[model samples]
Target: MTVGTAGDPVDRSRTVGAVGERRLIVELTRAATADDPSTTADAHDIVIGSGDDAAVIDTAGPAVISTDTAVQGRHFRLDWSDARTVGARAVVQSAADIAAMGGRTTGIVVSIACPSDTTVGTVLDLNAGIVAAAHGLGGRVLGGDLVDADQVVLTVTTLGALDGAEPIVVGGARPGDVLAVTGNMLGASAAGLALLIDAERRGDVELLRRHARLVDAHLLPAPDLGQGPIAARAGAHAMTDISDGLVEELITMAAASGTRLAITSDRIPVGDEIRSAAAALDTDLRDWTVAGGEDHELLAAFPPHAVPSGWTRIGEVLEGTGVLVDGRPAGGLRGWQSFGG
Candidate 1:
């Protein structure tokens, strides 16, 4: 059901509380499905979408589901990013999980909680971001709920279709498997975050422009969404999304597969975009490239000859436990940890 055009008139000055729940849902639905033609869902697949009690979908095989949440001041900040980017980032986080499981994105249900005084325009912008990201993945926004809260919080649950392929789990890496990663550079998102913080403090416009890619990586990361299934088709035995830092993920993969993953620091791809940012910040490049997190790229273990195109061979699985860099044990706390781990 189409609501209104993107340029249609609306009261941007009003708060969500002033607009009320029924009207807010109407606006949000319009933003999700009707703001742009590209964002519309395939009617046959989405049996029922927004403006309903629940969403119903038609699937060919088993459904893979994953959910992620973003909170104000924790996952994002209004001063650092616009509402639209925050919305898109939330969807990417959830979709990456589905992709890691070798599933095709089908749909998403979003739930947001924010202060009643939040502007209607901000909410609409956020919905538009969510809808656009979902559409890019050949999916749609199914339905969602919005409520009042002290801080803005977004929760996104994504549905995926396996298309008759076996799910690529994280526990199947054999000792002789080849460890590879998607082409997306590691630590760039962390580098972007660091650049954003430093640039804002020093008011360095030139530095910001020089490393815009790093900044963009943090604001809105576009993972290789298609590579997960590609890896699966290429005979990948184990896979994972590198959201919580590469080292942390590597450690988890090592333990889960009961094998050691060993690689050289020089072999890990650190793009010039990240290198310049690290130099500008006067920090160790490995901090961003090794211990940094939130790249959202896929890491998988494949047969030596079955590694897919557009992936970088980073390491090898050995008959041992844990991860090693440069033939030494990788130690110390790395990447993001909740509750200050």
Candidate 2:
């Protein structure tokens, strides 16, 4: 696949093969570090960075680790997102997993496999984005690998520190715990995706202009990185991020906890942007709010009286087997099934 838009006179025209692996590594390291020591220094000690064989991190207690991968055609498209944004998304999504376990990101390692013909500028942009995202969460890219492949692929492994808090898992919810979410901007990403897809097919300039925020949500999702730890501290019984849609997460939690999660349809704070998009597309608002994915908001079960601030209480847990919406079985779009389509 084409790495970046061509016909430029600078680095975009310089292919990775032309730069050679040694020079490419040096450039990528420079981009990742950004020549700033403050950004790289954090509570998690780093003994060695990119120059070493492997990253050496000094940490206390068990580390919260998670790995997420993004591919050229499968996870992202150059036409939809720039190389930097793609890299940022990869780090954010992977870091969210650590947050779900009641930890904060401390370090990141990224691996990229792309065709030799890929532009060096694109890879550098991707590295820059990864560094920015990691630094934003008090983390840094320690080291990684680069190699030739048929398509552009990125795999990010994140390490997190939980401090003194216990790691929140999926099977901890009790019957009386209430369900809560982190942000009010639920479903906006799905709405934005719908608008983007529609624009590609039919070109709706007015729609794009009116719902630009939603489009931004789809492309640059800002997951509440701190809320996961907050929820854990506030006595959350079970927790997970809404990566595969709210309903899907609810089902996973329910099955894991062996309880039923009943969320009211209206209790979820769906914004006007999502509502407008649903109306324009002639689709049910629940499809976006309930079944949409990639918001990356924290979903947790807390005691009714212990629901923390910054979290909207949406439902209650009951002794049952699966998820329910308004006392009925959740039907229709179950959410993004990776192998389904």
Quote model 2's TM-score: 0.92
Residue range 1-341, candidate 2, lDDT tens digits: 11222232346568988876666777677666665454445533676666567878875777899999989987788888899999998999999899999898888999999999999889988988899998888888888888999999999999998888999998899999999998888998888888888888996568877999888788778878898888888888999999889999998998889998899879898788788888888978877788888988889999889888889989999998777876767643453232122
> Each candidate: how many clashes?
0, 0
- Pick out the ten consecutive residues of candidate 1 with the lowest summed lDDT: 332-341
Q: TM-scores of all models?
A: 0.92, 0.92
Candidate 1 residue pairs in backbone clash: none
Instruction: Point out where model 2 deviates above 4 Å.
Output: 1-12, 35-44, 331-341
Scored by lDDT, model 2 comes in at 0.83
- Lowest lDDT 10-mer window, candidate 2? 1-10
TM-score, candidate 1, is 0.92
